[model samples]
Target chain A: MVSELSPTPGARSVSADTEGPRPPMPVKMVIAGGFGVGKTTTVGAISEIEPLTTEASITSVAAGIDDLSHTPEKMTTTVAMDFGCVTLDPTLKLYLFGTPGQERFGFMWDDLVEGALGGLVIVDTRRLDDCYAAVDYFEHREIPFAVAVNAFDGKVEHDLNDVRWALDVGDHVPLTVFDARERGSVRDALLVVLEHALATAQQ
Target chain B: MTVGGGVTKAGTTREVKGEDEMTAGEPSAADDAWGVEHPPSIVRPFLLTAGRIAGGDSLVPTIPIETQVVATDLGLATLDAFVFDQHRDIITICRQPQSLAEIAAKLRMHLNVIRVLADDLRADGQLALYAPQAESARDATVLRRVIDGLRAIPDSRGAIRER
Candidate 1:
């Protein structure tokens, strides 16, 4: 590469203090569930920045049966995705991406899960089924995940055991009740997910 | 006083007013080469990548990039004025290693489009890619650091709500 012009003002200065032996690597943990399952709230609670949003285009091939012959053909469509982030430290930043919970968008998970620490699936007891897709997707991918039943107004509509059984999460999954709006609760819930992630990573 | 969950009595009441709204469905616009008069449409994403549906490399959003030595032979001047501007802006911002996601967000360009353009720049040796060192998602030491970091965060409950 050749230098055409001087770098723009405010370019990061490579100094002894700023440059470390190892460059800071970005790590991400996904916050996933249905559309309104407090994904953004959980991110905002823990993120030092105001949980900025970024969009990614997701393309998936759709297979459908032919109208007359009952044959299968494929189609593709692109959709937008929203995400947020947290700066854990100067060396390691954590990103929290709120993915579409619908199964149709499952094709995009492969990209989202690459190098991800783990996932926290926030479930609303009133809409337990809303999070099933997230749980199933994580389980199938062998990604460590914790199901956090988000409490609304400090109330849990369903029993923890019942919610667990309904979700069919294995005993290995740490299921807990948490308040998404509370930073401490969200932080604690993420801790559980990290513990699971650590155990999984060690194995 | 802060509650155990990090919320102050006053903060909780104020935050409770807003629920997660599906505001993404709202029609949004972006500036194009022509300025604000012609807001970018949905098809603009395709145009950004020159109809290239796929990107070349595994440039994850988190990967960091920095400008290498400048190359006069990169033929940057031969490209469209708008493209040259985008490339120059990217090169300027990436003088110090910046994450790919931040570049996309800051530029207001689609992540995929950034990936394609960044890949093009890398191929021309104008940018250097610094991939994450984590070999696997389950790296034990990295996960431990993550756990410790999350635990170290002081009570942030209602404090964030007010902002």
Candidate 2:
């Protein structure tokens, strides 16, 4: 004989177990750009903590094994990233992660983006193509993101419109120029990313 | 049938076969070789803890639950919504059952601080203590499953699902 065991109508499933309220964790954002575009500086400016950086000296053994041409002048490399925190409100916190500014470190991007709210793509006007790798990565991943042009000294100058045209950024994407070293500018760039993330999440 | 050991056919009696007689000795032989022994019984116990932390507030412990410990223990930290915009480093390290002094030494934290956190975690049900060595294996399996589930969730920007 077939025995059928079924719950009565309107019976709640055991899956609805977590009904109580809990405090939320802070949101996370990543600062990404090409080599020496000021991703670390931007994160350090706004971070409340003594920015934790995992920079181990590139040893001679790693000289032949790893590519050091783009990173020769640098004494320390962000093997993982630099982490810092900022309080946005009484109930929310924002965590900033500065990713290594080289295309070869693309493998680490996926882990950095996990659970992150979104990112600010820091670009330098001198080398517009420098930001292309990050842009492409974010686009392919369908991650909500915004681009901020870092105005480096003696760098090639370009207006926001020209930069947008060169990057071929779509109309929905937000683009702006800012001094990465300034706190207010960095905060504004972050706000743009968060706003975009919120808008996209709503959609 | 003849008395003692004999087989009887209809209207006739004869000596029993050697095979039938040998079969009767098997039970005696088994009893002589090994006496009966009962299997050992074991019992296991465990505890579970959970807690919540408000923005700018320290982690607060909740009530603890007692149950059968299943495997090795695990610790996890979940960030709040407000802090999601900022980046922070969070690392979890496990300490085997030990005194507050030992734990502090291993983690390089002050003894008093470790005690405070441990007590809070224990009360909140976030920290779990298991009993009976067998439970360790089970706990390891459960912790692995939990980690796998967390990793399976998509974490990219704009990938968060609405409540």
Candidate 3:
């Protein structure tokens, strides 16, 4: 009996038993915040896969090159951003990118936000002004965004309404509380941002 | 040993080793010197086919967000659908245990294009390369560690609600 193996549909036949084609999947989201506002933690929380971090040693030699005014206590700096992924639905994938809070990393913002659908600007109520740069950056670019107030313990005692008023957030913008340390909160915050984006896009 | 030097149709006298010096029914010394005594006939044809296929390289078929099988199979269709619409036709196409060249060819795109797409896809966790079969243990361990780490991290929302 002459039996021949046939190529399966959606599968390619190659001679060498060495390698096969790679399936394609890519998605991105930006995590923006003031210095030390827990952007990295928010990403690390809900990331289904190993998060790729670009945090590097803050050497004195490179101090002059990059600004570290906001996060003076930070020993490491996210030179670019932290990358992670989560599957929201059967066909929806979410990529979390933690943007460097320092102004010197400004050059990277354009590239990082290239194809991003929207962003989460993590805020520390204690240092609300610190997040102004991120807010302005995203706003000026006309990118959809949500303000996630990362409430740190013993730092501030303000209601969510106060935060909204202080931040001058319009009613249309979604304001939510987030703990950079918790995965569910971060996930919720991300969802809020995504929902806000979807709503805005609909209009 | 009988010594006879004669130039025939080839015009070159070749030194023939005796059966005693032959191993596995062939000249052991000559086989060792040449590395391969007799190469399989299929090698040339295979290489030629590979070359031809790679000639018109374009871009590898990246994991189509809407059309990706892995995401659907893994029950991540919702996530895949979201990403697919946001970034249409942007994905890293990887053949299972595929060679760099084969991947490049299958995409029908340039090697650099495939490479960039692959890098992005890998960074995004949409594709993974299968290493050595024996390294499954190591791969599993690494995957476990990553999952554990993710699980250990406290959910940010919990902290927010507490305050």
Candidate 4:
């Protein structure tokens, strides 16, 4: 008889009753960038709750993938990851995860990147090269992403075109300028990522 | 299941992996007891998962769901004192649906640690993880809703808010 009941088609369900408060469908987006590029700040701006940090011990499973040039043969490196959430509706929620762009931390990115809608690779114009690793990883993995040049103090030293050329991201990628400090800007930037995610999903 | 064998009960600190039912150690007195004090900051993070570098890829369980969960009769029967505190906290908040990130934030524990604890509870049927049947990794409708929701948020401009 358990099999006789109709199951929900998309998400995995544990119980069958439909009238009570159900768990919201959890969807996530990633904010990837170099250190101090404001990934955490972007997540914090629009999150319903203050962002939280978690320490994860990333092991050597990523020896070949992560750029280990800085620390060779190191068995493990622990990093503090910041994340926040937005409730889109009673049944849908959006989670924003900020990831460190350092290649050594690429292994941990798997846990965050998988099943995510898309990514916003925040770039600091002053350090144009810092975001190269993120752009490479997201491009190679085929994850839909947008390059948001985070202008600190409402100031961008370089042209967005120059930053884009320096990163050498493909033409298909969406490159836009934004300030990470404002909630509205963060939300709009995420909207762009979601649009890209929607396009990819439909295809 | 018994918990805690080579445990050193020095103050409020104890190793959770040493007490997990899946781990090999035998159950001792402290295995089922709850620590009344906070664990010292010096305790290694891996000790919470019994020295396992990877806590398994079960982030799916942390997905927010609406199924109601009452703590199993077994409850915190075999949890270490510190783990029990977290377990009770989850049970109290989960009376209604909550996301894994919410639980972690409210409890002030690392998300990974909360993941391990939530998995433990699910394994024992002490917690029920309900995921929305209509949602998936790349659902078009869901993505659209997210985009709409983000757009609906009120605009913030002209002032630099402190983060």
Candidate 5:
């Protein structure tokens, strides 16, 4: 009865892996809005690389919602978040995460917004409701954010002030209009959120 | 601002603007790789992780999709140090620093699957994670660096950009 021998004799002396070309520091900001509010488009316009989707599937909810019948019933839907990275410098990387703003996906936001710098809530004037979840989430958490009304075809259905009033945000939130398709427009929109962050941090 | 709810809707946004020009759907892709019919993916994570996948655990300490992981040379040298094939596969992919999302995409597995597996190796000190800032209050210094990075982008649009 010979015992199973070790795969490698005394090969587990793993050394410290902290030398040379350390992995760059990663910082993230979320681009959140309801489906079709141009979260991915906003990421693509300014991302150095194409946006990538990570389908983080959640299986089964807490009791009452969890059906004990079948595997299909127990397994929940896949929560995908598209993200893109910008190499800020050799030592730093900034990630732009396009997250779903639907209420069903709220469970994942705590993890998503953790350590986030801020957020940008993209709005569609015709369907302001699409972005309301995003606006409320950021506000409730007091996470600095800016709301940008994405003017489809360069036309805003509602006036800027009207949208602001409808959102009922304080003077602190920066609300603006930007085109999701234009690279420069998206950049400016992000800057607006960062400006809010800077102001918040300075206080 | 996401409102709270108990409804359990799922599926990442149906599309990511214009990305992932893959030839086909995920279910079929896994089948093709195996060269044999495979069961639905809803069950694969359970089988692969022996029911220890990230979301399945109430306290697995999940990392963000953007978190970068790389293989330590010692882990690479002692390949058998890893317990499962997934661990080895992840270390192979991490020779060059890769985000969890990239590794998941490359392996054609769900992101949470990779999260748990990678974290296992990371916990063993077989891999190093260059993590984002922990859940904490946003700091002015980081925000200032982010602003500077955004400004560094070559203004592709016209001149006289508004500040």
Candidate 6:
């Protein structure tokens, strides 16, 4: 980023604007799970501002298109995600982006997690299978991730150990019980993910 | 299993060798003259990007979708020096600094489209991009800062005002 906002060609002096207010250093955390896993709820809980639902027009290939050079028509899928920002301070900002609700947008994950701090995979106790793909993606890429079982009604249906065994996550991955509706609960859950990522990286 | 995918048609396409994943293949000159379109809105995103199609991370360097973007003095002042309306919209929305994703959400454009357009504006000195550190995920300092920041946020029920 330019150290100083450029002067408007003699209209304003270089010193007119001090501190060269550039955008803050971005820190991203992915909130991923299968459909209806409270992924959006988790983001809204802790974000300073209202969460925004954004759509991405993803161009994905349909089945049976083997010859790339010969094919002309293409399929474009619309994927919508919910995201919100927390201003860590003036110099840093943390963004929570919920992965697209649908599972087919697997190709979008590489772009989402490449430079992110880590991931918080939300799971509803009854449907543990919804998050398997997310867990696999993060683990396979060696990106540190934590699992938060969203106890929607404040009543957790199963033990944390049961979820661990079901998800088959290693002991290294932090598995915690959290209520998706509470701000503190989601915040602590995210901290666990960051701590896990930090610890994993240090080792 | 693509759910409700809309398969759009394409005409003859020319390959564009690019330096980053933001790159999209150029629409062949024969399809339509480059930079010459009837109206900006409702134009196919690929055509709006002039048919520059980008793919996975393995192929090219990329800006993390969360990178911040702000308008330059020039961008804040005028729409001249830019061909695409998307560039102009980026400049206008960026008068106050915003993340690339926010801009995409505001502009209702695809993330890659915003990436490509923002890259163009930055190249033209119309916008500035502040990407996170190269190894941000592994940066302990950044992680510590984020952890501290999260700690500072008020977690009380009152902290969350209904939107």
Best by TM-score: 6
- In terms of lDDT, the poorest run of 10 residues in model 2 chain B is B62-71
| Model 6 per-residue lDDT tens digits across residues B3-33 | 1223223421222221122212221212111
> How well does each candidate superpose onto the true structure, as a TM-score?
0.70, 0.45, 0.46, 0.73, 0.75, 0.76
The DockQ-derived docking category for candidate 4 is: incorrect
DockQ of each: 0.14, 0.01, 0.05, 0.23, 0.20, 0.19
Ten contiguous residues with the weakest lDDT in model 4 chain B: B23-32
- Give stretches of model 6 more than 4 Å off: A1-20, A57-76, A104-108, B1-40, B57-61, B80-85, B157-163
lDDT tens per residue, model 1, A57-114: 3323332211323434222222334455555676666767666455443334665666
Candidate number with greatest lDDT = 6
Candidate 3, B18-96: lDDT as tens digits? 2112112121111011112222223221121122211111133222111222211112222344332211222333322
Worst 10 residues of 6 chain A by lDDT: A9-18
User: How much lDDT does each candidate structure score?
Assistant: 0.57, 0.43, 0.44, 0.60, 0.65, 0.67
DockQ of 4: 0.23
Q: What is the TM-score of chain B alone in each candidate?
A: 0.50, 0.25, 0.27, 0.47, 0.62, 0.65
Clashes of each: 9, 40, 44, 10, 7, 3
The candidate 4 chain A region of ten consecutive residues with least summed lDDT is A1-10
Q: In candidate 5, what are the lDDT values of residues A107-138, reduced to their tens digit?
A: 33655676778899988888887776677778
Candidate 1 TM-score over all chains jointly: 0.70
TM-score, A chain, model 5: 0.80
Error of 2 at A65 (Å): 21
Write the candidate numbers in order of decreasing DockQ: 4, 5, 6, 1, 3, 2
Q: How many backbone collisions does model 5 have?
A: 7
lDDT of 2 by residue, B1-163 (tens): 0112322232211111111111111112111111222221121000111121111112332111111111112223332311211111111333222222223323333222333344434333333322111222123332232223223323333242232
Q: In terms of DockQ, which candidate is stronger, 3 or 5?
A: 5
User: What is model 1's DockQ versus the real complex?
Assistant: 0.14
Better of 4 and 5 by TM-score: 5
lDDT at B57, model 4: 31
Candidate 5 overall Cα lDDT vs. reference? 0.65
